[model samples]
Target: MKTVCCCTVLLLLVLIPTCCHGGNILVFPTEGSHWINMEILLKALHSRGHNVTIARASKTWYIKDNPLYYKTFIVPVEQSLVDGDFLKKMFSVFIKLEQGTLTLTSFFQMAIGLLDKKLNIYNSVSSFVPALLDNVELMRKLNETKFDLVLTDPCWGNGAILAKYMNLPLVYNVRWLMPEEAHFAIAPSPLSYIPMTGSGLTDKMTFFQRVKNIILYLMTAIQSTFASKFVYQPLCEKYLGPDCDFNQIQNDADIWLMRTDFVFDYPRPTMPNVVYMGGFHCKPPEPLPDDMEEFVQSSGEHGVIIMSISTFVNELPEDLADGIAAAFAKLPQKVIWSFRGPKPSTLGNNTLLTEWMPQKDLVGHPKVKLFVSQGGTNGVQEALCHGVPVVGFPLVYDQYDNLLRLQEKGGAKILTLRAVDTDDGFLKAMQEVLNEPSYRQNMQRLSRLHRDQPMKPIDTALFWIEYVIRHKGAAHLKAQSNRMPWYVYHSVDVVLFLTGAVMLTLLATVMFIRCLWKSVCRRKVKLE
Candidate 1:
């Protein structure tokens, strides 16, 4: 009995150190704003006694604001590719192309420039690759510090590669739907699958849209394969060693942290590793500003409209702005527009325009009845968290998809830019959304569902992170993709083709046997 007790004590000593000295977390966020939410997650982990470190791009503004929170490192690649006269020329050509005023030769030149522009855009957003590599080298030099896990914003460039090179368990935090992995991650949307978003639409052919979708899918598949092989693989090989297989690394990731709620998306089969940590941006209710509070109380229960195009739509077209100003000028209720640029002179006394506003704070205000937004995923989550019905004007990427889900839920109205160009269209859409009580009620229902979650999103995220640390790695949660061939991975098409082939073979065999049997029977009768 004493020997057993001693052994148990020894085991406890070993495990206590291993478990209590929680593993270090390496975070690579796409931008400063992403870090804000990540910081909250890290704080939650810290409360549970985990050591966390942030390795982020230097140009990110949040780094400067909160130096104590992170161990900062500068990336070698320049964040912006174009400056001075070159940028001006590119912008001028792009504007002309957009307006359909460019000559054929100029159009070709613009096309080449646009391709270059895509690279530039990627560079501006994902220049952290070099810096992350530097961090790896720094870790190697220290020899004492080894990270147990890597948490990266998969929206940025090549974070998966870095995680692989480190041989650390990776948890991808996807801010939006990944174009390359959309079919596997979520249901394929016609818009993303057709013409590949930026390609020009041609009117010459029948069933052209379906053809376009097929072609785009094939092209995207090829491009994704190449990116995995050439870009992502080479980086891993260069840092980790020559023996590392990039394909295997993707399969080895511990989890995919999806910022999507089941309430918003339709039911779909997801891997065990894929966790829904949506609505991390949600905050508890707070008091509104004194002036705003006074206004809300004095309005005799008349509601307010909150309008913002989100950060991506920072440069709204003058025509669109004018249309919005004109529409709002005629409205009876107070309108608060979070315009990023100079205040438009056309807005009437009932409307207020500001360069910046506390978005969550404004959304939670009792007077805010409706939200007019560009349908950014984060903005939509915030609106839903605050029980504000939306008037979504989706601009690009998955914004359209997000709004479609909300509209289908009967909690929002979708106003496409194409329709919003006309004054009557904009006014009618706004009136329809604002005057309807069902929209408000539906939003409230969703808000209640979100609030009644089993656990806070931040807490859930932290628990998973710690769970991984406690277990050394939650590798058991990872999906086993390496065992299956590509055909088997997406086997619905293969199964149909195989079934057809088998049926044809059986039919042919039956016909041949019937012919042979008839010939034999005829010969026997003749002989008799």
Candidate 2:
């Protein structure tokens, strides 16, 4: 008994030191669907014994106080940046924009309206910068915490600012960095082959398609510049000082846990510090609830179809919803749709409508034949991970772009809102995906490739996080290109320098020939 007690004590001593070595991590997360994956990451960190402290706004929409896993440092705010109502309104506008039959005037009006809404959102988010930085007590507490690093979602912009202010290494769990894709900010994104977000083009482009890609890229660049100059620059000057540029600091993160995979995304140049952990949140599905399992089992030979547009959407327009319902009624398969708001008048008895459903679990189920999605990153990645073919109804933002990649790979098909609103369009799109074996085959191939990595994406991300903690930061892995000016990074200055040198050399050669010609003429005259 005494020998056993001694062995137990020795084990405890060894384990205690392991627990004590866990890193102190600070997190600044974005609200809405982004937080879903971020929460998964935070939980993983906590499970590994790391101490996590989140900085959340007092009026945040999604981030809530969680004492069990991580501590919350709430920063007081006048109002929340986003809420359910705001999302609903924005989605309504997006639906209208997608389904609207636009003339020239209407298109211009829509563009202006979108620009106004974007500016408003930027201003709302930027408001938190001053509110958090101006709080003396909060700043003091944060400094005293002495966190090893700041893990953040750069979509909010405030995270980058906060990291800079804290003087800690920044690591991003990111896909989009407000106003553009994260890769555009830090990596070499060549416009010729690499499709721009919202362009709806593929890597394999024709002449006109490449033109469209370049135009879309330029427009996005213009928007990004405007956001940096007007929205983020003033805040940086006031809080971080005059010499601090928003663009430099925005790309200053030591590691970028990019929520993208080469298997799903187009092949493009990437950076050393940018780690691809695209579907890190995805895992094998757990058993469904008893009732849900029973429903899935009842489908039998015909199989089941899961439909979800993700959290941002509460419901579709009445007519659109009715069309979808009537189409589902015609099909033999059972449908599980995640929806809220009023039920469609034509909802079939075979269809189950709930406020929420276990999306990833449903997609991973063996009986699931098809996945109807709204083309959000998480949903698309989940579908890819589960080897389910998708019929995407893209509404706004990067949804179109995300779906386009899947379509290009032959794993999914995209149906516009206008198409879905048409009489037989949604039904036809669904039938195409269901009847075709190629869709399933291609998606399964992609799933295999995505899963064939040396290590699981989440494990890879965790290793890099620990790597950063051990080394203090990943400064050696970062590229110097982030520090270079635009002209230097793009080699515009070098191109101009080379052009000038060539012109001078040509002139000098011409002058020497002219002088030789004159001397030859003089010698001939003297001989005469």
Candidate 3:
């Protein structure tokens, strides 16, 4: 008994440190506000005693002085590819595309234009590779760190390459719901149900809509391949080694940390390699700042509508801003509007304007009635976290798709920039939301589900990251489908075999019938 006790205690002593002393973790997120939500997981890991390092471009160097980051590298790569002004231009272009009077052809033509702009940006931004490769000091510093694992964002190419360069296992941290490429990477997303984002289709797809989804999915695959071949592939070859390609580097990634949960997303198959940490970034709402608290309190019984737009929300078109203000004037609810553009000449008595507001805090407040937003993932998730019904005026990116998903879920309403043209139309929509019981009920239900998960999102996310480290990248969890060819993954060969068998059987039937008829005719002639 004494010997057994000693052995058990010795085993625990060895195992305890394995759990508590997590390894050196390196995070490589692209340059933007998109990294905000994802930072939650990284912060948690840092607090849990892991040494976390954030290596990013100079344009993306926004992390404050916190002990959470043990080291920070702002790799000066040419010029700032991303900045406040650049994002505003991109958002403005999307608003035009979303609000323009567009036919089917015109929509596609507009899409082509958008693609050209994105391609240019991607080319310029991805050129950071040459600079990073050129910096011998930076290379030496990264090599010496000896990170145990790398957390990657799928949106950019640098994370994948950096993982390779550092000889670390790659784990994709996707901050999106859908793109055909993501589906292919994580699991099989059937076209019969899963809709292509930005195609304006939902999970409950009509046959025609499914057809469009399939077409869009194929187009998306082609586009990813083209971009990779031109932009990322060459960089991999030039930086890592002669034979390396982007596909090869990405395929070696051990796991995926997808930012989605069933509370907001439709039912879909998930692989063991993929962990969904949807609301990890949603901290419990803090009290609103002094001035903002007073603004919400003034609403009294009517409650306030928290109106916000995109990151470039401040770039609202002059007329749209004025029209939105006009619509707010007709509503009974007080409006706390976060305006970025030129101030509206006619401000409503019930409306309070600010350059910025703590959006999550306002949404969590009991006095908040509805959220008028652009439907970005973080904004939408915040509203959902607080059980507030939504009104979306989505402009671009995944905003439109996010809104449609909410509309189908019965938790929100959709409005157009055009709808705010006159006060009456927008007022009617706001009133509809205010008066509707179903919207509030659905939102509350979703909010409860999101909050009532078996484990906190932060814990779940941290467990998996450590799990990867403990298991030396957890390669066993990676789906074999990742290695399968497209034809094999979709059973294309099986389909072709069945089709060919059917055609061959029909041919044999026809031949047999003709032979029998000819034989019958010959016998009849001989008998006659």
Candidate 4:
């Protein structure tokens, strides 16, 4: 036994030279389902023998501590974050945006409410800097930890400051289909072609849609600039000192683990550092608990309709639930809804309503025929993995963009609930999706492509992560565009230079022509 122990130690020592044992990855993910996406990546890394540490906001840390990480840092939850109905209000705003029916006054009203709530929440997040600044001991303790990389969702922008303060490399965990700042950081996507999030347009745009896409991109850019100047930059200056700017550190990331994939998207350009791990959350269907299995099996030939609204949002209205319930009752299928709060009075016998269900597992089940969802990125990705067609009832954030992707894929139809007064439209939309054979065919095609990828999303993520650690930051993978100024990146400077040269040449040519005309006239007069 002693000899065997000695041999094991020797083997480990020899392997150390050739292999990267593991890396210490610090992940600071945003609130809600975005954290779930990051945890999937982190948990996978942890299983592969990497030491992972997580820092979470106290506001949303409702569950017990995660055992996947070596340590969990619980930041003191700010009042602004904890004390707002941001998600609920944001969902309310999105209810107005279904099918582009939102009027200017109502849209502006919702926008103002959402912006005010978000600014407060993000202001508190930005105060992460001030908290670090005020507590030297905390900062010292954090700095003392020999972290190799800083992994975070860049939505808050505070993570960039944290990475800058720690002098560590960054790896962005983008939870949206793609965040605008992320493209600003690394990719050279043209505003003319690449549709911005919330545009409700796909990559294949008509002339009018492209114009609209351009307008949306410009609007988003303006909003981001204003926020940086007023909100984020000032906070960084206050805590990170005056020299520190939020944007300077945005692209400082060594890698981007973007939650997007080509199978679910149109063909588009992506940089080497940008890894599309869209279906990372997708896992083999876990065994359904006894009740869920019984409910699904009971459905028989009718199958089931799944209405899972992802996470952390207000429940559907009771009346709308009744209307949806009524529609499901009329069909031969069973319905499983992951709803919160009280059960609707009009819920049907065929519909086995649960407050929550194992979404991925049910979607993968042979009995689940169609998914009726809020069209969250994760939910959409989950649906695509199982070949389940969707009846998308999109709400706030990237839901519209996600739904548009599905619509383009021909596997889903929009169920607009813009007006709160009715559910007639939703019922018809649900029926339309269910009755269509093409939806099922397209979804199956997507599922096959997703599964038949060169490598599984998880494996791809693991490879790239280990590659980064082995090469020490992998700085060479960064695009040249990441280093260019905004003016130079968009070629605004080149346009100006070319315009000036053209104006000068035109002026000189006109002068020479007029002069020659005058000289010819004088010569003709002399000859006469």
- Top TM-score: which candidate number? 2
Candidate 4, residues 258-296: lDDT per residue as tens digits? 787788876666788888887888988889999889988
Q: How much is the lDDT of residue 196 in candidate 2?
A: 83
| Local error of candidate 1 at residue 211 (angstroms) | 7.4
Off by over 4 Å in 3: 1-20, 61-70, 96-113, 177-181, 240-245, 493-528
Q: List the residue pairs that clash in candidate 4.
A: none
Clash number for each model = 0, 0, 1, 0
Q: All candidates' TM-scores?
A: 0.78, 0.95, 0.87, 0.89
Model 4: worst 10 consecutive residues (lDDT sum)? 175-184
Ranking by lDDT: 2, 3, 4, 1
lDDT of 3: 0.78
Expressed as tens digits, the lDDT of each residue in 1-528 for candidate 1 is 999999999999988986766767777665534555667666666666666677655454444434444454444454432233444455445434443456889888777876676555554543455555666566664235677888876654466667766667787776532245332433323443223432333212247665776686677667556555645566667767787766566556576777776777655556776777888867876777777666556555567788887453445566657768878877777888888665555678778777776788888888888889877777898888778898886655556667766787788888766455564677788888888889988988988888888898767777777667667677787655554556776686789899999999999999999999999999999999
With candidate 4 superimposed using the best TM-score fit, by how many Å does residue 290's alpha carbon deviate from the native? 1.0
The parts of candidate 1 lying over 4 Å away from their true place are 1-22, 32-36, 61-65, 75-112, 120-137, 141-143, 175-178, 181-216, 241-247, 295-298, 488-528
The C-alpha RMSD of each candidate to the native structure, in angstroms, is 6.6, 2.0, 4.5, 3.5
lDDT of 2 by residue, 1-528 (tens): 999999999999999988877999999899988999899999999999999999888998888878888999998988888656767777876777777744668668767876788798899888888888899999899889889999999986888998888889999999999878899999999888988888888888899999998888888889888988999999999988999999999998999999998998999999999999989999999999999999999998999999998577767888778888888998999999898879999999899998879887888999999999999999999999989999998888789888888898899998988887686898999999999999999999999999999999999999999889989899999899999998998899999999999999999999999999999999999999
What order do candidates take by TM-score, descending? 2, 4, 3, 1
Q: Which ranges of candidate 4 are over 4 A from the true structure?
A: 1-20, 61-64, 77-84, 93-110, 175-181, 238-243, 418-428, 502-528
For residues 7-71, what per-residue lDDT tens digits would candidate 3 score against the true structure? Answer: 99999999898677678888876555557765776777877888888776766434443554557
